[model samples]
Every structure is written in C-alpha cells, then in structure tokens.
Target: MSNKATLIRIAEAAGVSISTVDRVVNSRGGVSPDTEAKVLEWATRLNLDRRLFRSHLRTLRVAVMMQSPHNPFFEALRDAFSDLNLTMADLRITSFVHYIDVNDFAGTSRKIEQVAAGYDGLIVTCPNDPKISEALRRVSRKIPIVTLVTDLPDSGRIAYVGSNNRQTGRVAGELMGRFLGGEGGDILLVLGLQRMAGHEEREMGFRSVLRERFPSCRIVAALESGENRERAGQVVLDALREYPGIRGIYNVSAGNSAIVQAIGSLGLTHKIVLITHELTEARRQMLLDGALDAVIDQNPRLEAQRALEVLGRNFQRGESGTTGGEYTPFQIFIRENCPTISY
Candidate 1:
C-alpha cells in the first residue's frame, strides 16, 4: 500500500512542527517569515492541497442599505454588486438590501441599526439625520462601515464610494449658464432630498458657480420633491406659476421624470434649459427627446464596483485601502453624446 503524505509529513520534510505548517496553511499567526516560506514550498512539492483550508478563511457578510430598489439607478447598482459577487472567487459576499421611504430618516435609521448587527460590514446611503449618523457610529465600533452614494456628515465612516458631487454640480451650473448665453432670469431648482449630502453639495456648488460666474442669473427658489416624481412635477408647476420668468431648471436628484413631465405640459421644451444628475433610462430618454438639456452622470456600475473593491481591500488589510486618486470620471451627457438607455 502506498502512503499519502499529510500536512505533518510536509512539515517534517520542511524541518518544522505540525503547528507551524497549520499556521502557514490556514494563514494564521506566529510563524517566522523564513519558516513560513519553507513550509509552503514543501507543502506545494508534496501536493498538500489547501483547497479545504478555505474553511478557515473568514467569510465577510456585508449589507447594502438604500432606498427602494424600484428606481433604475438603485437597480443598476444592485446588478453591479451581484455581478461582482459572481466574479470574486476568494471572498464570499452576502448583500442585504433594505428599502426605506426616501424621506423617512427615522425609519431608515432604525433599519440600518437592525441590519448592521448581523453583518460584518455595511455599505449604506446616508439617511440624513443625527440618529442615523449615531447608529452608523455605534455599529462602526464593531465592524467596518462604508458609505455609498451619499455621505453622513461627521460620521467616522471608513470610506466613501461616490463621485465628487460638488464638482458635478458646478459642471451643471456652468453648462446651464453657457446654454443660457449669459441671459438674466430666475431659475427654478428642483431637488429630491435636501439632507442627502450629494444633493446638498450639488445644489451648493451649482448655486455658488452660478452666483459667481453668472451674476445676472438668479436661482429664485429651491424646492424639495420628497423623492417623488409627481411631487417634483407639482413643485415645478407651482414654481413656474409663481415665477413666470424662470429661464432654466436644475434637477439635483432622481425626479427628472417629474421635471420632464412638467416642462412638457407647459410646452416649454425649447424655452427653458434643463440640466440634471444621473443617466438613468428616463433621463437618457429625456435627453433624446430634447426635454432635458444635459445630465451629470456618476456611473452607478463603476461606483458599485469601487465599493466592493474598497470593502474587499479593507477585509484583506484590516484597514481602509489607499485611494489611487484615479476614479471613473464623472461624465457629462448631452443630446450629442448621450448613450442609449438600455434600462
């Protein structure tokens, strides 16, 4: 009968104890660098396969909390993360999705606290409230937390995976100003949630740039649409009625559908310069239909991939990974170069 070499046999050949071999094979602690290398070499030569050793590998379960999955943008992000899970062979990723009414901060915070308990890590869109931030902080003390899409102010999150929203906003403002040809008139700003850091930064950057560069153009009013398309449409309708001289509109969130509908109903397609964020199907169609002037896209697929990469790196290193600084560039989509919407 032929004898099969065991892990102990490999350790003996490498002149080390079985415990040392165990440490090297299981990727545990307390092995000298030279001894670890020798043990690995001997194990490889003996074909001491370590595939079973993966049972000892730590499994990372992460939760991704966001608003309703019905939105195409969130759906795209979910799809991207799912694809990432299929591709990563070394790590096991479990994604937990929670749907919260976009404007209900308290409900979102409670959900976050609940899910944060079961997972090793969290990837979340901020809920824009102190309670949510407190919940994130409390949970972060136990596990790593990554902020996705929107950021929580003063929250000691590990990393933020999203675009430079303020820069994108400035770009929108610049485009709006140029499209207006320096003409002076009131502009209506339709927003989804004011407390979302992304939305807030975008609005602030847009306002700052427009005020400084195009002094004549005035943003007369900014209204929150509560993340509802119908509400957004109603708000725009009210704004148009209130400010008859509105020459441009800036949409800083997901209510582009409402903006387009309101503008269409008013028959002001060619009259107002409309700019918005995100490149969802609706926005792309609006751009194609000439109802929307331009869109500042954050590229949800890239953002999703980056979030996973960051979490994976943090798991491997036991700390936040380095920012390579180079990121998927924020894209400016206009009618001339906008991609066809598949969703």
Candidate 2:
C-alpha cells in the first residue's frame, strides 16, 4: 500500500482520526501508547518510507480556554486569534472556547478536568484558586500548558502570555500619585474581581508602589464590583459617601465606566486623575473627554498574536520558551497612544 493509504488504514484500525494519527507520528502532542505502538507496527509492516512518512505527518491542534466571550477584551483576543494566518502545510489551528464564571473555582476546575483529555496544548487564564492550579498540573502531565492573562504561581505551566501586572500597578499608582499632586489625600482602589490573578497582582503592585513612594495618600478602602457596571458605580458611590475626602481612584480591573459615572455624579471630572487598565471603548472616550487621566493597556492584539505564535511554535517544534516566570511588561496607555478600536 502507498504511505498515505497505510497511514489511513492504521488510523482506521486505531479508531482515531487521521489528524490524531499524524500527531502520534510527529510526537507533537499526547496519544495513547497502544495507539502509537499500533501505528508504528503498521508502518513497519507496510515498509512505508520513513522520510516520506515523517515529511507528510504535519498537523497541530491547540485549545484556548478562556473566560466569558461577553467581555470585549477577550472578544478582541478571540477575533485576533481567528485572524491569524499561520499558512503552513503541517499546521492546523483549532481553538476551543470555554466560558466560566471568573469567580467560581469549583466550576472552572470541573470544566478544566473535563476538557483535559482531548487537547494537545492549552492556553488558559488561570483561576485564582489552588484547585484550578492542581487541575492544570494534572493535565500538564500529558500536554504542554500556557497561562494567559492571569497566572498560577504554583502550577507547572510552561509559559505565560500577558502583561507585567505589577509594573502596570506601579504605573497606575505613579499616575495617581502624581496626578493627585501629593500623598495627603484619600484614594479608593476599585477592583473588578479579586479572584483574578491579574487584578490581584495589579492591586499588589499599586499598593506597594503607593506605600513606598506616596505614603501620605491613604488607600481609604477597596471594594469589589464583580465586573458589573451598575455594581461598580454603586460601590464607588458608597466609597465616596463613606470616605468624603476621596481625591483619587485606581481601578485595577474592568468597570471603569461605572467609576467614571460615580466620579461625574460627584462632579470630580478633571479634578482627580483616574487611572485604570484596559483601554476599552468607554475608557478611551472618557480619556478623550478629559474624564480619565491614564490607562494601562496590555496590547490585546500583541497578546493574541503572541499566544498563537507560541502555540504554532509548539506544534512545529514541540516546545516554547515565551514565559520564564518573570513579570512581563504591561503597555502604558494614555489618550495620546491608545490604539484605535475597530469595533
């Protein structure tokens, strides 16, 4: 039989798709040893050309596991990935989208465990709990894993693709400190969700920088807004009422619109330098309208491109070195350099 015919026959006998057979032949991802042995035995029995077989066996599959598709930032990322053109003969990219409540550890963990069996590589936003970390570790035994946006410090993930959250925090803190014109006034730290590792790191970095550089500015209180605009607005309103001297605000997560509304309600426009992350549509408008002073943006396009490149490299060479367990730089954005939003 011809080489392709032999491969197809072996794949049929193994009860797996041709792509799975290709993966086994190339050692790109995980396949059962029995399946691998069967394919190898068939190749030997058929005396298929080793060089020809290796040359023709080229296909890679990767899974991208993320949070809600409803979020514009993640939606942008998804669109970016779909737009990638890794036009190579041996590479086939497939993305699997999963939506889990960012705050639900158990639910996320269950989903991870469920999907861990089928994928060759994983790109995921790490949940802020040990259970999810443990689940990732369990899966890494079989396939390479990469963390996206957020990180799991203890998980044996191969690389991370996201911003240097601490630096982002420090940048926000510096902007707030300078814009507030000193450390004597009160500032509120608003977070979208404390369970997100990205938010947690940003908060830490912001607080660390503020404490060291601007000790006079007290962080009056922090409240979680759960990424809800209404909740965020309400939280800021409550904080404003509770701490009447609030002069500045640092948002380490989403829900910036609500914060802006609360500030406008109090008529603090241009009076306080507001700093946040992710230059979404509302944030860009607010900055343009002079309601927001600065924003720390992690380039979603670059992040998405890097993610696809990492996966592509892994599929091509079975390895990647993008993440070295150090803080990656978070891009700083103001009204001046914010990239124009397409949709």
Candidate 3:
C-alpha cells in the first residue's frame, strides 16, 4: 500500500479526504491554508514520516455577532470571547466580536452575509426574524454556525449553546410571586426585544408559572425597551403612572439600569418586588442595595466556552449536522448569595 493510504486515520481524524491529506503532507499546495493547517496538525500528531511542514499552520478566524455594548450582558459576552481568543492560540482559533443593531433586520442580515464571508465559523445572538434566519441559513452552507443565548431552529445552524430561557422566565415568575407574599398585584414586564425568541420564551414561561401557580398575580403590560436605558426607564415610568397597582416587576432583557432608575425616581424602590436577568455589576449592586430582589443569570462566559467547543468539534469532524441544542445551566442570585466576583 502507498504511504498515503496508511494516512487514512489522520485524514479521518482531521475530517478530510486521504487525497487532501496527501496533498497537505506532500506540500503540493492544493488545499486552502486552513485545510492544510488542519491536515498538517493531524499528520504531526500521528507521527507520519512522509513530508511534514510545520510552518503551514494557519489561524482559524471565528466571527461572533451579538447586540450592542449598551447591554451589559452582550458586553460581558464580547469580553468572554475576547478572553477566550487570548487563550485559544493553541487551537489556532481567533474570535472577532461584532455588534449589530437587532432592530434593523435588513442591515443586520446584510452584515451577517458580509462578515461571514471572511470567517471560518460564526457564533451569533440575534432575534428570531425571518431575514436573520435566512441569512444564517445561507451562511451555514459555507461554514458552521452556532446560535448563542437564543435558538434559531430553522436557521440551518449547527447548534444552540445557551440557557433554557423559558425555564429562566418561569423561575422569575415564581420568585416575583413569592416575593410579593401572595398579596397579588399587577406585575410589569420590561423586555429587551420583542423579536428575540429567548425573551418571548421567557415571557411565556413567566406567564405560565403565574397562571398556574400564582393566580393572584397578573401581567399588566409587557413593554419592549429595545435594550435602551432611557427608553426602558420612560416606558417603566409611564407604566407605573398608568397602572398604579403594579407591585411586581421583571425584566427579561437588558436596560436593568433604567428599570432601577425609574423605580427609584418614582420612590418605589423598596415598595415593589423586582427581578431582572443577568448578574452584571450594576445588577449585582442593585441586588446588594435592596433595589433588585433577585437576578437570574445565564453565564455568558460558559456559553462562549460551550459555543467554541461545539465549533471546534465541528471543525475537527469536518462535517455538519443538527446536533440539537445545548442548554447551559442558569443561576438564581439573591442579595445573600450573589457572587462578589465580576463575570
């Protein structure tokens, strides 16, 4: 058998054809730089003794698309990816973070198409809009895509790595109800984006729990803040003015700062039971100061790690198929148990 034939294990391990491996091993220069690098890495690991070039290794570029830094959660998520990039040199993976305006569907879709052309893989957190999904599906045809913090089930993405938002919302509902001590007053919901599937799922779960377990509590209104602090604060303030009986509050997305400010502005800081998502520094401080009652945190760092793992696995396997969703665990934090470390 030819020496190249014996390299089948390496080819399989690297998710490439034996002929491709042969070309990379012989330095014939037919494969893409990344393909060559992957093949060479596997060949080196296998100790193949034909012709190996260590200098052909190439860094794999990964694109991460998320919301603007106005939201602390996305900012933390961007930082998580940045930190991973520093340490992922061994894997030849580098991640670039990009923020997109979730409200502009056409612009966001175009951005994905343009940015995806230069990257080997994509990890994104966008609304569940048809345009965005179609963009993702089109991009998935060329490279692997992983949905972060939300699921785009029909987007042809490889996997979703984030928290079960529905369960998260349900937890918030129960906490709000219990915190209200069964007095049962109208509750106000401040959501980030109405198009975000995670936010909607959270709303569903919250409503379900309230309907089944806490019948006395009712949702007065669900206002979309678009993750804008000023808008969040104004809508919250208006809701308070309109619904004088609103005694409980839950924010399914960002704008927690605005929520706190609005509540405090109205002198209802200690009078209302409030729960918000994510354990940002601001939110943590609010919890400590008795401004926020509790926080349901979906750790962005963990999600980043998991999404990278999924991409790494897909690259090594050299194939893509729906692997279903990977649900990261969520944490509920109260003043007494909130962590002191910044995430």
Please count the clashing residue pairs in each candidate, in the order shown: 0, 3, 0
Error of 1 at 216 (Å): 1.2
Model 2 residue pairs with clashes: 164-328, 183-216, 183-217
192-275 per-residue lDDT for model 2 (tens digits): 888888888889988998889888888999889887668888998889889888888887766778788887898776776688
What lDDT tens digits, residue by residue, belong to model 3 across residues 197-295?
999999999999999999999998999998788898899999999998999989887777778888888888899898988898888888999998999
Off by over 4 Å in 1: 1-19, 22-55, 320-328, 341-343
Residue 35 CA error for candidate 1 (Å)?
15
**Candidate 3 runs further than 4 Å off:** 1-56
lDDT of 3 at 158: 94
- The per-prediction CA RMSD against the true structure, in angstroms, equals 6.3, 7.5, 4.6
Per-residue lDDT over 1-343 for candidate 1, one digit per residue giving the tens place of the 0 to 100 score = 1223477687789998877877777778898888876876565455445463445445678888888766667888888777777776555566666667767778777888888888988888865788888878888888877787877745667788888878888998899888887566789988888988888988989998988898988999999987777888899988988888999999887777777778778887778889987788777888888888998887777787777777766665456533432235688889999987543
Residue ranges of candidate 2 with Cα displaced over 4 Å? 1-55, 85-91, 320-329, 337-343
lDDT of 2: 0.74
lDDT of each: 0.77, 0.74, 0.87
Candidate 1 — number of clashing residue pairs?
A: 0
Q: What local lDDT score does residue 31 receive in model 3, on the 0 to 100 scale?
A: 92
Q: Pairing residues by index, what is the TM-score of model 1?
A: 0.83
